[model samples]
Target chain A: MFWQQLVNGLTLGSTYSLVALGYTLIMGVLNIINMAHGEVFMFGAFVGLFLVNYLKVNIFVAMAGAMAASALLGILLEMLALRPLRRRAVSDLAPLISTIGVSIFLENLALKIFGPQSQAFPAGALSGVQLQLGPIRITLVQIVILGISFGLMFVLRFWLSKTRVGKAIRTTAESIETANLLGINTNKIILLTVALASALGGIAGVLVGLSINAVEPTMGLSMGLKGLAVLILGGMGNITGAMLGGLILGIAEVFTVAYGASSYRDAVAFGIIILILFIRPQGLFGKRQGGRF
Target chain B: MDIILNQYYLQIVIFVLVNAILGVSIYMTLSTGQLSLGNAGFMSIGAYTCAILTVKAGFPVYLAIPIGGAAASFISLIIGYPALRLTGIYLAIATLGFGEVVRVIILNLKITNGALGISGIPTLGTKISKMLSSFGLSRFGGLTAQQTSNLLVLVVLIFILAFLVFFCTRLNRSRVGRAFASIKADESAAEAMGINTTYYKLLAFALGAFIAGMAGGLSAHLTFFIGPKDFAYHRTVEILSFAVLGGSDLIIGPIVGALLLTMLPELLRSASEYRLMIYGALMVIMMAFRPQGLISKETVRFWKRKLGRRINQ
Candidate 1:
């Protein structure tokens, strides 16, 4: 039972890791939380859903479509909500509120388009094959989900380490002023980072939609909060911490449902976040003690 | 008088007043530069306490309301001490988590009826009627029962507003307010100057909670129902918009914001379906053009200088 639950937790956690990766990346580069990232994720899921349901496209093609659409959305969000505020040199909280406005607009727009109801993906999209390893049972879709998520994480890691843009992102994250001194276009880097992070969020949304078999406008609300919790738990701006935090949160929630009252399952992520805030405000893997949030 | 006293209009006015109070509640904490998203949770605490006292405990509405505010204020102190350690978005996320925890707990507790919520709350209108009759002023000024109830609520709102105005003016000039402003301007500077940042932050947080709690108590009686969904993250965002869109710099900013934003939906009833969308667009536009909000110190000062000179002439 424990092993089966662990498998389920990993599947759930992988999606969380994807979302948190987006959060960590944005926080690292911009020092601001993109409140609309969750909406971007939701939009991605709807894009993938539209392709799969209406066009009967393969899952891989739908994911690519979703990623491209969401990347576009990220750029639009920057132009409409963030860039203006940054140019104006508004208060620190201005961008946060602006992103919130974008989130609200996108959410309500989706509600209008999607009719305020959960859209279910037609079944049998993935091959129905269960693999039994000793006492545990795993579905073929679960294996595919895990593979795709881990594969994406590795790709992200490699790109960040090897690519020129990746080094630029890391340098910008360290100090924007210094990066500018080095002649890197900080503005372009910020834009690119936002798009990349938003792409990850979008793909995660599609994966989650597939696993859950339903997608809705309101799906972003809970997922957004949980992603934030995972980001904090893993240490803000720590890529590896976000991944670990996601898995831990996923497992903890699964255990709560399996052994404890199922109703408190939602509380697990939030409860852990509060406890961590009290004991270790810097988070578990945070290197700096009191750096910029 | 008839138009002003109309039940529909009066109800709207009452809401505007209550939301104004909520706006001030958040403004209290914002002044200290702490971005708390837990005001809605504090409001729930106040609403539930007042509702239960009236429904199950049979306490008077007058007595239960203050107690509710007190209850929320007390809880704020407990959380503020530790949570204030984080800054910026981290503080925001922590408060957001705290709110969710409060909501989840309420959803599971039996006393909260597990999402069924508390109903059958006595309306403020009936209480006013009872009080007027006992004083043999039931027909005082020949007012109707509905008008009397609304008048009572308005009186409460007026008193609260008056207190806020006086309190804000005094705070702006007082030592504590300077401490708050200093902390907001630069915490390290304030600490270096021997100002107790923690103590003042806690005070602002607690005061904010109390006001929000009081607003919640009034709302519970007005609506005659209290539900977990009423105090969710959506509400937090709405209250936040009230302050941000209005202008947090002045005491009147949030009140003006509440008045206009509350009346906006009514004015644009034709676009009711698109109300939130419009609101969202407005927020983005406002942030882009005038991030200081609809009202700010400079605007107020500009008007004051113009009007003051005219009045003197």
Candidate 2:
């Protein structure tokens, strides 16, 4: 039972980590929380659904298309909305409010375009396969999700550590002004980072949609909140921190629900965040920076 | 025309007034460099307190409203002390958690009546006897029930509006207000200058909560109903939207925002199902175009200068 719950927790955590990675990347680069990220994830799932149901594409191809489309959309959003604001000397609140606005706008737009009803992706044999390893019974889709998520994380780790652009990104994350002085194209790096993050969000959305077999407009708000909590838990602006945070949250939630009441799941998650804030405000893996009011 | 000015319209107008009160309360904290996402929770405390006291304990309605408001203010003070120590996004998150916790507790508590919600308390319209008597009218004398209710609502709204205008003027000019402005500008600098950041932060939060609680009491009285749904996260978001869209710096901004946004769904009734979506989209566009807000006085001055240049050309 413990193992089953642990596997379940891991699968859930993997998806959360994917979403948190997106948040961490953007925050690391721009120092802005893109509230519309969850909406991007939701849109990705809708795109995946459309491809599978209407175009009869394979699941892998559909997910890939969704990720690509979401990335393009992220770039468009940056160009049309975020870029112009950055050009002007605006306060940090401006971007926060603007992103929130974008979040609302996209959610509403999605509702208008897709209608309010929850939609399911086209069903397949992937839904039927459940593997029993001793006392632990797990879905094939859960295993697949875990495997794909790890694969993506590995690729991302390699990309961040090994590439020139990756080093630039790291430098930008460290300090934007300093990175600019070092001859890095900070703007281009920010755009690239946002695109990459959005793609990850999209992939997570598709996986979550497939796992749950339902998609809706308001899913973004809850998912975004959870991803943010994970980001804080692991360590803000740290990819590895986000991963660890996600796993901790997932496992904590699973165990809490299993032992306690299901109603307390959300409360438990929030309680953990509050406790973390009180005990270690910098988060588990986040480096301590200069404190300000 | 008479029907148009009757009970339903009176109800909606009262609702608008209540929302306006809540909006103003939110504006107070926001202007002072703090964001408490727990406005709805404070409102709920006021609503529930008033309802429970008036109905169960049989307290006079006259007494209940102030007591309710005070209770909410005290609660805010407690939460604000520890929570406001954090700044910016952390404070927002902490308050958000606080709001959710309040909601959860209310949902699970036996006194709250849980999901079924407390119902069939004494109607709020009955409590306006003193005001009516002062105007040479007894309770239900020389007026229909609808007329009496409308008068009660109108009187309460006028009273609130007067209070808000007075409060705004005082806050915008006072030393404390200047301190708030300084905190908003730069907290460290404010501290360096010998401002008690902790005291002022708590003051802002408590004051906001008191106003919100009063609004909640008025809302419960006007509607003759109070439910958990009335003070949900969506309502908190809606209040934030009002403050954001209108311009947080000015006192009247929330009032304008609440009036416009509250009536917006009714105007767009044709697109009823997509109303929330449209509202969201409108907010995004507004943020994208005018992050400073719709009625930012600075932006207005800038625009005026540009227009003057065009005229000179």
Candidate 3:
């Protein structure tokens, strides 16, 4: 039973980590929270659902289309709402509130367009295929979710470390003005960073949709909030920290449910976060913020 | 005036007043240089406390509401110290977590009715009816006793809002308000100026929580039900928008925002499905064009001058 819960927790944690990456990346480079990111993820899920269910496309094609669409949206959001605010040098909370406006708009738009019901995937490996192991059974959906989540993180790490754009992104994170002085296009880097992070968010959306067997418009709000918690717990703006945070949060949630009431799952994640914020504030791997951000 | 006493208008007026109270709660913290998104949690605490007292403890409405506010304020005192230490987004996020955790605990607890919520809540609607009958004004609008009772909620709550407006205006000009302003501008500078930044921040939370608690008590009685879902993150967003859209710079900003947004959705009820869409778009456009909000002192002066000229004409 313990092993089974652990597997389930890992699967849940991996998906959260995937979404947390988007949050951490944006915070790392841009130093702002994309309050609408969960909506973007939800939109990605709808796009994937449409591709798979309506167009009868392969799952890979659906995933690609969703990722591409979400990436485009991320760019547009940065350009339209955030870019103007950043240019004006508004207060720190301005963009945060603006993104919320954007999020509400998109959520309502989705509600009107897609309707309020959850759109389910047609019968596939999602329901029928199961993997049986001794005392620890997992589903094919779980395997696919875990595989894709890890694969995306691995590729992201490699790109960040090995690619020119990756190094440029890091430099911008370190110091935007310094990166600009070094002859890097900071604007392009911000755009690329949003796009990459959003792409990862899109991938997580599709994978989670596949595992859950349905996609709903409201799916992003809670998931997005939880993902933010994961990002903070792992140390805000810390990549590897976000991953570890997600795993720990997921396991904690599972154990809370296993030992106590299932209704307290959301409460437990938030409680752990509050405790951490008070005690450590900087998180496990994060340096104490210098009050600049 | 007769139409004003009718049920439809009364309901809208009560909602406007309740939302205004919530808006002012946010405004209090905002002025103190903190962007707290957890007022809804405090609201829930007050509502549940009031609901339980009136229903289970059998306390009178007048007596129970104050106790509710005190309970919520005490809880805020506990949450404020650590939560106030963080700046900007971090503080906002911490409060957001608190709000969610509060909601979840309410959902799980048996005392809150575990999501079925507490219904048949007693309210001042009846007292209002009796008072109106005593004044012989019950016959003025041809309103039934029940309707008069309902409209009484509007009158009593509007008076509460007026008191808040007066209190806040006075608070803003006092030495404490200056402290709040300096803290908002720069905390270290405020501290260097011998302002007890911790005390002022905690005061803001305490006052904000007190006001939000009262609003919740009134809300539970007005709606006749208290549900956990009613105080979810959705409410936090609404309260935050009031401060955002109304402008947090001046005393009247959030109240104006609360009144306008609450009435806007209803006025656009013809569009029905497009209501939230329009609401969201307006917020974005408002922020993009005017992040300072609609009722800054400059704008207030601008409107007053325009109104004066019109009156002279």
Note the residue pairs that clash in candidate 1.
none
Report chain B TM per candidate.
0.96, 0.90, 0.92
Question: What is candidate 3's TM-score against the reference?
Answer: 0.95
After TM-score superposition, what is the CA distance of residue A169 in candidate 3 from its true location, in Å? 0.7
Poorest stretch of ten by lDDT in candidate 1 chain A: A284-293
Arrange candidates by TM-score, descending.
Answer: 1, 3, 2
TM-scores of the candidates, chain A only: 0.96, 0.95, 0.96
Candidate 1: stretches off by over 4 Å: A289-293
lDDT of 3: 0.86
Across B9-29, the per-residue lDDT of candidate 1 in tens digits comes to 888888999999998998898
Q: Model 2, range B33-130, lDDT digits (tens) per residue?
A: 78778899899999889888887899987788888899999999877877777777777766766676777677777898876667876666665755
Quality of candidate 3's docking, in CAPRI categories?
A: medium
Worst 10 residues of 3 chain B by lDDT: B139-148
Worst 10 residues of 2 chain A by lDDT: A284-293
| lDDT at B5, model 1 | 84
- Per residue, candidate 1 scores C-alpha lDDT tens digits across A234-266 of 888888888889989989998899997899999
- lDDT value, residue B192 of candidate 1: 100
